[model samples]
Target: MTDLARDGTHPGAPPPGVTMSAPDVDTHCPYCALQCGMTLRATPQRVEVRSRQFPTNRGGLCQKGWTAAELLDHPDRLTTPLVRDPHTAQLRPATWDEALDRVARTITGLQTAYGPDSIAVFGGGGLTNEKAYALGKFARVTLRTRNIDYNGRFCMSSAAAAGNRAFGIDRGLPFPLADLAGADTLLLVGANVAETMPPLVRYLVEQKARGGNLIVIDPRVTATARQATLHLQPMPGTDLAVANALLHIAVTEGWVDKDYVETRTAGFDAVRRSVAGYWPAQVERLSGVPVADLETAARALGTAGTAIILTARGAEQHAKGVDTVTAFINLALALGLPGRPGSGYGCLTGQGNGQGGREHGQKADQLPGYRRIDDPAARAHVAGVWGVHPDDLPGPGLSAYELLDSIGSPTGPRALLVFGSNPVVSAPRAGRIQRRLGDLDLLVVADFVLSETAAMADVVLPTAQWAEEDGTMTNLEGRVLRRRALRPPPAGVRTDLSVIAELARRLVGDGMAGNGTTGGRTTGSATDGSGTTGGGAGSSFPEDPRLVFDELRRASAGGIADYAGVTWDRIDAEDGVFWPCPAEDRPGTPRLFAETFPTPDGRARFLPVEHRPAAEEVCPEYPLYLTTGRVLAQYQSGAQTRRIGPLRTAAPNAFLELHPDLASRLGVADGDEVTVHSRRGEMRAPARLSDTIRADTVFAPFHWGGAARANSLTNDALDPTSKMPEFKVCAVRVERA
Candidate 1:
């Protein structure tokens, strides 16, 4: 490794023999959506992390952020490409040229045999904004396939869907996290912020100190629930009923803000009629929450001068996730919270770049700046930016789960390009998804380590890690921040941007051309690639992050998440800039919809919703309800965090958290091995008995793969609107193993 300054200046750039101390680079943590600011000092052996004052984390770093530097030089980090041999059926180290050529040839052959859609690309929520934008453009311009989607679909699609429908825009948070300090009440629905993002817990403490109330709703008595002034322990999958009952209580108690509702919102009459049947008693019977607690929670929210509702995966990872989120939005709207100064509705995004990943064109049905793919105007605007014909771009494709389920089928994709995600362990029904990957004719993966998903790939391309890359990430507040390169990548390793650009150049050389017209025109010779592709000769993907962001600004000019005004220099000069900053002179809008909503009528819409049972109901044979979540020591799938010695030792393996009564009934003591059997499969793990959880519900962290994978028992029932899988609740049977 070579010494470099925080401004990305190399020591060699100075006069010869001039000794320069390695300057600490100001960068953000590579963990969650919080994107906590940190300074990194690069030494010969390792990198050191120190907290930097930022609005999101405020000079704080979680355990994961503090230990993130260890991942850069982990013993198991991949340094070279690996290609599987057809004869030996084993992965062998290979040069970059050989590995990339093999991948390109395999994809081309599959396209020739099955069609362009036969090759699909799957992205991850943790990818930087530049990488996500490039991946989407690659899929449309190079592969010319409508089969591109990302892991964000499984994380926050439900919340995004509801927010788009209600507010005419989808941002995880319309206001900054600091606003929580001024709120009169904070209602957290199924979100364990204390354990998920520890720094955020301070806001709740500040609210309490200011004589405000805090409400937590979860099935278990999580760490966050312990600090709440009122905790409503509702049964899993019944959050809709609880929300409706709260609205019903507000209406009956005359707590609704008549002036705000009448002037700033619409469809309240229908929502009021819909919740008329969900009284306190009925809600208690359905959601297992006491009537007294429900009334108390409702009263606190209704009486507050300004209140905010925050939700997480626990509330949105269900078959009726969209409806559940919509119900929460309805309650916020009735109280006139959306555009209020100190109140609104927001979702806590889980992944590192989850907010930015979905804003670009990585999702199936969206273009850059969160534009709809099916809209002609949006297509024209983006196509012009890419120097391609509008008709050359493929229409909306299958979503994340649907694309995975289509593998190996007659009309499914035969080849897949996976970047930044480990679907083998993260996707629902892990056993089935593993088989689908095995059935693919060609599988290519670009990752820093040989993750569970990468181990199954035919060609694994080693890529640069976060500390070795320069990019941008949008935090939960829709604030775009910079990620500076702290050190050079290891020899033989490449950034994802470089790899994608090189591969696109090779594919374009094979005769694929961009559509030459300005209008819709389907080219011929799909196999020969002689016809015009969307971004044929005109497409030139720059490997530099700054250049990619410049093109991104043009593509996102007029869309909902406009970022034309955001520049790398501006991000580095300030803490961060919020999106919808469409002009260079604008300072960026930190808070949106202050006086009016984005709808045509400038009013928020309230949708009526009803409660539904879990996708997989408990039966006589499988009497226990199974729920999955994360632990503090590990991140999603533990692909990178698990490699660190300290973090791995802290959380050695997964375990089942069951109630004392349930464990005793099953004849299992603490640390006893138990077999959790579900309809799809079964997993064995040690059981730890605790009284924090409900007697009928058992919890397991979903950060491990193989024998301890929690997704093996998760249900894949999709929400009709958001297409989110039911990962929170399922039926299972527990027995002493």
Candidate 2:
């Protein structure tokens, strides 16, 4: 193995070398959703990234993005495919042929014994657009399975439910990040952007410079809250109460957008009546915010000429996540924030290409282009494009939580395939999910690292990382951009698409494609049923992304988005172009609802939401509220970044964040090992005492694994509507080790 030497770059170091050898090779930092544009300087032995001028971030990259290059060729990376002995739990390196054959046989056997519904596939938001799209299609058309979902269910399902109910669509933000700087007021409901997306948070600083009023609402004094003009530390699970009061004030004070509501909305009367009982006084009791503070926030949001509301996982990780998000939108509508300049509800996406992954049909209930699979018309449209019979398509299936539970049981799925996601670490009730995976008849996983999830797989296929793959991604604001591959994969690794193509052929026969070698290794039976002839003997399967995208374009015919003008040829000429560009004759819709909405009556709907209790309540046995979140140095689950030298050096291990006052009462001090136990599990980690959080609440970074895995202690109960797990509010007890 070759050991790559570092070029003296730290996680937070600035870019170096102004000029690059290849100009078109200019790319963006491959971390976080911020996606700071950068130019690459390639020397004979090393590569350096230099910040480039771009609209989103003014030549700035966070620690994770700046040090991404160091992770390109880590020594611990999985370089070959391995097939594990099911009975002995022993892994052996095998040719691609042997691995694919074993996987195909197991899937077929599982289908024959338990039916096609007994096979499932799990996807991730971090995968490139092309890879995510292909995985969804393969699960349905080739494998004929209804159980397909992604980690987004754990991350953004609440925000999606809110958008679909409020505005009849689910794009993150109507306006771009730059527009935030032009607003008169910006309300950050549940996000800590300064610590998460620091470069993008520059817009908020600029807005403050313009005399814009910034309001931050959270249970803690987060980094972003310290910079806000007003900070309201509401009690836990009480955001809905505060939001309803704001709406009550808007309606009573005649601040509601009467014309917009009367012209383009539904269910206003129900919402108005529901919020009537939530006056400032009553809400002040429900939430920790004072009556005066609630009134001040309402006035700032209502009287301001332009304002917007931004939410994050903090608001959507609760048991009532969907209801809380809807309340937020209702507050925005009462203040006339949507369908206008510099004002709307924006969800800061957690994954780099989460917006794109959802749009491309990787979600459980959705098809390509945000089309619902349950809708016959949408099914027909997509089926026609894929050249399959509508009757062949599967119906809506279980979400991630249900899917995980379904593994191994007779009535549950027996075969499971994973791509780019580590469920063993990210999924709630991690111990249960791990046991279920081990009990499966077959489990196949493709990743760059031997993640905790992959460690239990029956088959493990090494795949190329982001820097070794060429594709595209969609940003939080629905902007599409290119992902350029700057180097080649390690010795025996291959692209994800290649493995999927081979597996699809083995299961469904020649109908899938040819050779099954998509820029990867080739061995053994090419007879895994890949060819040009099947139902239609002479028809050829389109394997190249350029060809598949054309069919996708045709699938979106006549909808709000048209792919007629968006050809691979066109996209190749530049970085990339946003969709709904429609044609060469039209410009892309930068902001939605500028004139009208896509709702049935051309009006948004007001969802009457009520506050609900957390999944579990604090008791004598579990007396603390445990909240999970991320740090700037690591991504979710930390499969790749945590393995890198720079990232590991910054924050070496997980620590429990507790209030100093609470620690004092408990006889605990800084750096003292403590045991945190929940209803399902317990973990011991060093403590960090701080006043940033409430005395009754504790915080943990959800990126560590092993005995310290945070999700193991998280509650698995899901929101009835969105099927999102209760990751934020879990009851636990802490004591000295």
Best by lDDT: 1
- In model 1, pairs of residues that clash are 513-533, 514-533, 514-536, 515-533
* Model 2: per-residue Cα lDDT over 272-304, one tens digit each: 999998989988877778999888888888888
- Candidate 2 ranges beyond 4 A from true positions: 1-24, 86-88, 510-543, 559-564, 568-575
What lDDT tens digits, residue by residue, belong to model 1 across residues 253-330? 999999999999999999999999998999998989999999999999999999999999999999899999999999
**Shift of residue 453 alpha carbon in model 1, Å:** 0.5
- RMSD over all Cα atoms, model 1: 6.4
lDDT per model, in order? 0.87, 0.76
| Model 1 stretches with alpha carbons more than 4 Å out | 1-23, 512-538
Score residue 218 of candidate 1 by CA lDDT. 97
